[model samples]
Target chain A: MAESEYILEVKNLCQHFTSGRGRKKLTVKAVDDVTFSVRRAETFGLVGESGCGKTTTGRTVIRLYNPTSGQMLFDGRDIAGRMNRKLREYLTSNIAMIFQDPIESLNPKMTIEEIVGEGLKVRGNRNKEDIRRQVVQMLNKVGLVEEHATRYPHEFSGGQRQRIGIARAIITNPKMVIADEPVSALDVSVQAQVINLLNDLKEEMGLTILFIAHNLSVVKYFSDRIGVMYYGHLVEVAKGDDLYQKPLHPYTRALLSAIPEPNPLTERTRVRIDYVPERDHDYSLEHPSMVEVEPEHFVYCSPSELERYREIIQNA
Target chain B: MIYDRNNLPEELLNLPASDFEALYQEDIKDEKFQTKPVGFFKDAAIRLTKSKVSIIAFIIIGIIIILAVVVPPLSPYGFNDQNISAKYLPPKMPIVEKLGIMDGTRVLKNRKVSGLSDTDRYPEGSIIEYFNVVTAKGQEMCDVRVDAYMLAGMPDGEYHWFGTDYLGRDLLTRLFKGARISLLIAFFSVLTNVFIGVVYGAISGYYGGKVDIILTHFAEVLDGMPYIVVTILFMILFGSGMVSIILALTITGWIGTSRLIRAQFYRFKGREYVLAARTLGVPDRTLIFRHILPNCVGPLITRAMIAIPGAIFSESFLAYLGLGIKPPNPSIGVLLSDGQSVLLQYPYQTVFPAILISVLMIAFNLFSNGLRDALDPTKRGEE
Candidate 1:
């Protein structure tokens, strides 16, 4: 594949944290050897249960949290480990992130103009008029009026604040964005509105996004490709429709089964399969690694389980 | 999906022109619009004005400041000027005398002629009389010639509005001068402490881990020292003066504000906006000072206001203990100490300084309370 095809690539990313003191020290492997890539102008959705390292993976890829060991290539340049001033500046200008909680994500004391224009100011734009012009333009693009520029974040609703958050993220015209559960804290109606707005912005700006969420249905609706994470490991990766239609991993099947169907008959009769890793997989002998079951569909399983999974796909 | 007016859909083009005009018509009401936005400080000031008690306190403080500035120069008697004859004179208001509220005394301008003729010894213009004098040791009687030239203007006698002190200095002038020194020390000490505390605390709290740990420990060690003992040590080493007293108070004064600011910084540091600023490439210095510090202003201001009374009280206490302002230059504390010896004979000496200190402390505390309530956004609607 051409290097320009993908905007961001992560290979074997690891992030560990140590807690407690002296003899009672503990190391938590928050993100353990996760690998993924986001192609240009495509949304790569990472779905997982809470505390399964999906958010941590997004943060580490953006370099908000330093990776213990990994190679994160943004535009074919390595930017994972210790960064120099030039590389940091490059990363800051080229990539941005949208946090989960809309209310807490914005500074309560700052006006909408300052919050959105902060990036330009930090990048050394001294002209106030130019900054305001760009900020107003971005605000209008995010479905906010010019009057909202001077208002504080506390005055806005959750959905409106998220739009403000989005405006702030893309004001510098970054190439890629990492949206960490941006709609999880919003109302159901507002969630759809924010998601649609994000989709529209992605198309208009030609932005590649790493959308991290715990909701399987939302991920299926928004992403072109999806990766399922369980216990700090990426267990499966496939095209969004393909993964939902034909899931090979037991964990993926369980996750898909949990999504509530709209039809009354199916909703009443659907039986959710419980996936217990200990009961299902006998990984004591050979630890499972990610293996390709078919073209563009990968699963975490041993050689024997891989053969079984492939036979099941072939039979179906 | 581009919709040009000329290329409108067939169904929309078939609609009548009158219907299109009717769809846009509605009531147009005239209303004034806001030309500018209100800032935080402006909003706080507006809210502060609504509280009646705070306004009264503000006016009282204003009067005291005016008195401190204007009264000292206009007074006929200097703060240190003395007359032994006028010692322990009772208070007499000039306005009361002019109003004829009390009878004025008349003195005879001649000396008592016991062994010689009255005209030869009195020199024709002098009045002889026996005068009573009281000393710290005992009371005595003395014969003196009262010259009319010395008693011309004061038909009754010299008037002392707040009466004269033991040194026969005008108590009113001394009180005003004392207020000037006390208020200045409080103002400058609080300003110094807040400036140092905010900077130190912001740096310590913004950068956590080893830096925070070391700085916090250092602050704790300083806080552990007894304030008065440290103040006395500073006084002994540097000697008692305005600079020394201010230094003594500031040494430990900044600890409280620094701790307060540190906690606030710690709380705001984890907030997502701060993280967003960091990811946006804002420098650490800008993030700490510009982004994080402004949010802590309300609490900082309230804390500083409350600190003033404490500073004033400390200065007065030190002066009362003879380690404050020296004797000749009057401090409230110095006046109180001076009055303590003659308190049984003359209660007015102690009463005036006591009332002034109490009024000042009460006013400052009430004003601070009002400021805290006014600046709190949660309390806005309650008013």
Candidate 2:
């Protein structure tokens, strides 16, 4: 990715977890040498199966988890693993996150007002009146009324609650948003609504986004560029439409093929590539490594396979 | 109850029976179901109100407080002054009498005395003396003043309402005075404990690693020492004054609160909302107090209610052992010790104070248990 065009850059980020007993300890490489960037006004989707460390990568970029190694630059300032008071306030004001589960993501006990206004309270040292005014405006912007401010999370529908969550995330006027499966928990109809809302806000605010999900079809529709992860390694990265049309990596190809096609005849022609589920297999050794298969396309392949893949790409 | 033709418009109330039944059921459930108001503290308050016993106990305590503050000053007698001459008398009983009718034919009889006999019966039926006595035939008579031994240091002519102690202090006055000290000790000790415990536990739980380890070690060290021993050490160091007792009681009281607050913090700190706060750049203080503490406050308040009775009982136990409040400053503990000394001769002294202590302690315990039931967020569904 071009450095100047990026609003956020994550470089070679690694997060490791150690488990098992005594000398027989096993280490799980959660986010191994993952690299991607969100351009100034673009949606960057991260796709993988469960346990692919996509969530871990998003968390690390926001510095919720201190990266074991590597760097994350938010607007050209390295934020990974280094948190100060000012940096925390800066992050709160500049970047925000929308979570997966609406029920769990919002605190059950707080009112809509307290929940949405919390970001502002944390970011700006404003008086109470100003916070309330801003909270009301944000709530109205998210299609909630003034009366809803006093109501609790349980009072609202799942979709409405997610909107409240979005209102909370955006209340601080963040420049970038890390939406971690923001719509997956809602009903299918509600999912489209939330996605549309996010898209509208993205355009209106000129925001950068890191949208993470397990669904390839959803990301294909929503993201500007897509990065495909297979067991903690970035297997491929390309323009969303290009990747959907002509995926270069085997994992990406299998993922694209799995998306249910609308028409029967063309769907039948779509290949079903049978392989081990990447989430179940331990892919630690394959990580901390990647090969440039083609211009702007990277894959984490073994040395022997890397040469073969490079040859194929060069001929193409 | 709409009857419509089969060709009626669909909008003209042709709903199915099941739909009507479902709507009725929903209405019924809505009427009966308990709903929690949003916001942690308000929800907690609603929950807390559900405990009938806590509410009653709180009222009783409030009445006691009013009496402690208002009624004592209204008393005709002071709390401390001793009338030594009237010592060791029994509880006062109201005396009613009518002099024998003396017409012109009957000689007028003086009902004041049977010439000051040790026997409880006076010579005439008109003069009533209230005392418990053993007759010469060995029957117990509670109506007339006869046995001199039961009267203790009673002078020849006086009406002592509710007999005095060995030092001639009024029992009622002493009881009230003792209440003042015992309750003060409970309140002050609880204040110190909650302050220390909430701060200590919150910081340890919030920061959780080196600070937690260090605090845990400190709490463990304090926990290892016996409560009485700790109290005695403080008493020796600071002396057995009200301040010293408060200091001693609070020294060990906070451990329980710390454990409770720490548990609450641990339960809530790792939740998604807290992590979200951290990601949003909400400072540590706001996260700890605004987000995290409110989650924990329900339990903390409940635990504090439970701790008050414990503190009161501890002070009482210390006083009963003669290590608590000293003589001249009547705590229930000191009164209890005094009662024990006189229990064989005057069981009422021991019985009244002991009963009061037990009643107060039990009331507080029931109240605290009710608070715990009401304040727990997990119990919201039940409410």
Candidate 3:
């Protein structure tokens, strides 16, 4: 694989949400110093449990909640700088996000046409006919027909609304898309349909996707590269197959072991690993940071543990 | 029925390959909606009509508004036309006259029984009857029933459906004319209140943080002003005209709407659709007007409708305090104040105006209640 282009580069990104003032002030480090990158035309899956800041990382990358600190470079443009009209324009024109909840993400009052065409309208496409034409085409690409355009979001079922959301995000033809658990809210049967549609679109348009989901199996099936986050920090990053087969980090192992086996007999005896950060690592002795254990495989560990991870890779 | 996989039953083993088919669809598409598209207002309208009480109230209001606009010009007796001789006539409708109710006859208590037949004191056909004669200290006295119209010597063919007030002005014409003026004030005040409230609240709630804090403090300061004092100041500045009264009503009146709108904005601003819009780089103006504001419209419209009756009542209260529309330009309040002075002598004068205002208030209130239920999306299709 000679592809060397990185479409988006995020370095030490932090997103902290704070409320109140002075004595009563409180802060939540939702996304802490997390770093990763997405290559052009590649799918990067971010997997984490609830409240692990995977979603926060995706939102911060799209500049939804402005970064508290850290730097983000998209196509070599500094996006983590101060938010101004020009930066906002630049960010919106390139990157679009698909929210998690299908019902919550869509505007209930707007027609499907208006909801999907809104992206185009924001980009200065004011011709009603042109917008309608493009919107219908995008809807069809997502397996919805032209007739559904005039209908409100509430009329459609969950899966259809999600498809409409996908249409809204990709209609602008952005180089990168942040899909935040797009199919987690859908039924199992509908989930495959949406994933396949996304795969086809990604291939058709050469789109780089930052796919965020808690579902390990879905990410395993969809991602070219995978990053595992735990409690506001990324603990492992590797190819999809390598991460699934040889999870180097303790948290990654615990997450992989948690996937229930299909066979009743094997499932009954399946070993589930529990990871306690304090017991798993001696952070007092040395600070733990990201270290490359193999080519294209990075694990978060201190100097001593990094030696062990490198040995494990060399043995395999 | 249990067959081993290694040695399956002949029929099961021989099952045709053609029998197997996939239920999983490769592509999913939504079915076309069979019903016509129902927009926000259309949905609200459908729900509103389902409420029987609201429909009745709406019709009553429509008729009253139509009459308020149509009655004053059509009625023969001008609202201010006064004839001293025709003072204090009872309602003398020609049709209801034969029915013996409101037949223009009134009982004259403590009259000399001998004077019942005196033509000069009681004109021809003026005396209806007399009864209950009592000898009070050798003076024979009785309650004498006489035709009030004839007692006042009004023309034979003439009639006053609501009768005349102490000023001898036609009550029906004056009451409806007052309704017209009162309705105008309510409508104008409510429109301005909603407009100012929506803009102010949108700015405060959408921009939140310091902008919200400063705007809220300003509104609180304004709200602290004593309402009556503000009205008094406005009256002094502008001379108690409709413009002055409407301005007074609006000064603090819009604060409620602003608060309501502000709360609605705060609730909706954090919704995912709004976040999505922000991520899409939608300008703040569009986000405020299109995304967040439309959701608030359901409550905003309901609030505006409810504000009408409140404004009308406030105007009447001002008029009651002798600050209503300038004299001779009748409002319900002015008519009411006039009727109050002669309440004992002419109860009909007070009764008619009182009944009209009461009906107007109740109608508006019921109609607005229906509108609230209708506009609530959660209550859609509910009876």
Candidate 4:
């Protein structure tokens, strides 16, 4: 990939959280040695089952949680480790998160206008008239009327609330948006609507997205490239179409096989993939060494298997 | 349960006809609904209204306050003056009985020596004596030796309305006067404590982490200290007075309130709205006072109501030990202390004040309980 094309490059990002009753400490690797990058105006889909550290990876990349050890380069600037107050503020306004739960994410007392314009307010864009105009315009773009802006979050339907959440993320005009399962909470029909809204916004705002979800079909349509995670580790990374047609990793193949075929006449038999319940033994302290198995395709494999996959891909 | 506008409960949607659409628009659109109400007054009022018991208690307390303030000044007798001759006088005891005691003249003549000579009747000395005495009339000496304790002759009246104490002071007047003193101390002590607690708690909760640790430790240390010991220490330094009692109660009283406020602050400080405000660059003072403190009002007001009765009880306990309001001032504790001897003879003196105190306490207690229920935010489903 060309150097100028990459907006965010996450390298070997690892976040370990300690959870235990007392005296004894147990470490859960929330995000383990995960590496990926988003090019300018490009969407990178991160797909994994729940508890696979997908959300943690997104949050850490946004600096909500300081990673145990890793490097994150945004606009070619390394912003890992303890951030200064000004730097933190800059990051908040520059890259925003669209949380999964719209009801919990939006404060119960605030009006739609305030919720949508919260990003602008946080950035100290205090001209009330300007904020009002911008918030109304953004709400309109998200298919909400100006009157809805004055309403409380509880007054709106779940879909409308998600739209408000989306408006809040976009109001800052951030270069990148980390949408963590943004539509997973909505109904299937509403989910489609939100996904389409996100796609349209991505194009209109020219925003790079790190769309994290479990829906392979949605990710296939939303993202240019996809990364599959299992047990806190990013196991495979490939182009969206290429990954679906020829999935290299066992986990990705299982995940893709689970998606139902829409064509009734295709006579497809669903493939059941046994998900390995990740035990502490499943991940050792020693990190899996990653290898470029093909052009623009990376996989974490055992040291001996790396050259084998490289040769196989070369021969193919 | 999602309320379809058409199926909304009447009580739930009891907004004034004029405000229906307007409030709906504001409720649906305003950021405060998402952020939480800015000030506590609205929510506090709402919570207070919901508690039926609290409202009743409030009414009872209001009546008690009115009685305490208005009833005493109208009384004819002074609270402290003693009429030795009228000692041990029962309430509504006929004038004939008082006249008969005076008619004998012998009991009055031997008042100092004859009264004190008896061992069982007068333990210390006969300040007052109750026994039958003969009158000067030869027909049938029927003058009664009324056990009336007083400093001087009884006031020019038919008889004692509530019986006199050992000092021959009017028991009814003293009770009323004591009620005033007790209630005042309780009111002031609670006010002072709540003020201190809110400020202390807000600071501890808002700053959190290291600052929280320090304040929490301070609260813990204070909490661990025996309240009785503090009262004694303060009494020794300041001597027994209303001021001393108030100071003692309030000094440690605020610790509980502070702890409560601090806990509330911790709960609310990291909420999404608080962080949102911080990001918006809202001032720290506004965030703490406008955003966080309102959430605490329900608990604070409820606690404050309950604490008043507690303060009054504390003052009474101190007075019972003679470390509260001094002589010339009446408190239920002081009245109970002074009435121990006369309690056997003229039980009304002791019984009346004791019962009043108990009833007042019960009323206040019940009211406080109701207030607490009313002020709970989670239970405040109604307006």
Interface RMSD (Cα, Å) for model 3: 6.9
Model 1 off-target regions past 4 Å? B1-38, B94-159, B380-383
How much lDDT does candidate 1 score? Answer: 0.82
Each candidate structure's count of clashing pairs = 8, 6, 0, 38
Question: What are the runs in model 4 whose C-alpha is more than 4 Å off?
Answer: A1-4, A19-23, A109-153, A260-268, A275-287, A302-316, B1-52, B67-218, B238-244, B258-297, B325-342, B345-356, B375-383
Expressed as tens digits, the lDDT of each residue in A136-224 for candidate 1 is 89888877878888977766789888988999999999999889999999998778878988898999999999999998878989999
Model 2: chain B TM-score vs. truth? 0.74
lDDT of 2 at B6: 38
**Best of the two (1, 2) by lDDT:** 1
| Model 1, span B177-255: residue lDDT tens | 9889888889999999999999999988988788889998998998898877888888999988888888988998998
* Candidate numbers, best TM-score first, in rank order: 3, 1, 2, 4
Per-residue lDDT for A25 in model 2?
96
All models, RMSD in angstroms = 8.3, 10.0, 4.2, 11.0
- Assess each model's interface with DockQ, reporting 2 decimals per model: 0.24, 0.24, 0.44, 0.12
* Winning model by lDDT: 3
- Residue-by-residue lDDT tens digits, candidate 4, B1-383: 01123444676557677765622211122232334332224554667666777678678778877877876777667887787666666665445446553321223333333435555554333244444444443432333343333223434444455666877787778887888898889989999999999999999999987888898898889888898887798889998888888898887899999989999998988775565455434557877876688768778887887887788788878877878687888887788877765666556777877887787888888877766666665554454
Q: Which scores higher on DockQ, 1 or 4?
A: 1
Off by over 4 Å in 3: A1-4, B1-25, B381-383
lDDT tens per residue, model 2, B1-383 = 01113344666446766665421211100121144445655655677687788788878777766656774566555667677655665555334212321110111232233343534443333233554343544443444333232334343344333345787777766776787788898888898999999889999898897899999899999899887877787788888999899889888789888888888889888887887777777777887778888777767777777777777788888887778786788887888888788888666577767877777777788888877777776776454
Query: Candidate 1, A219: how far from true, in Å?
Result: 1.7
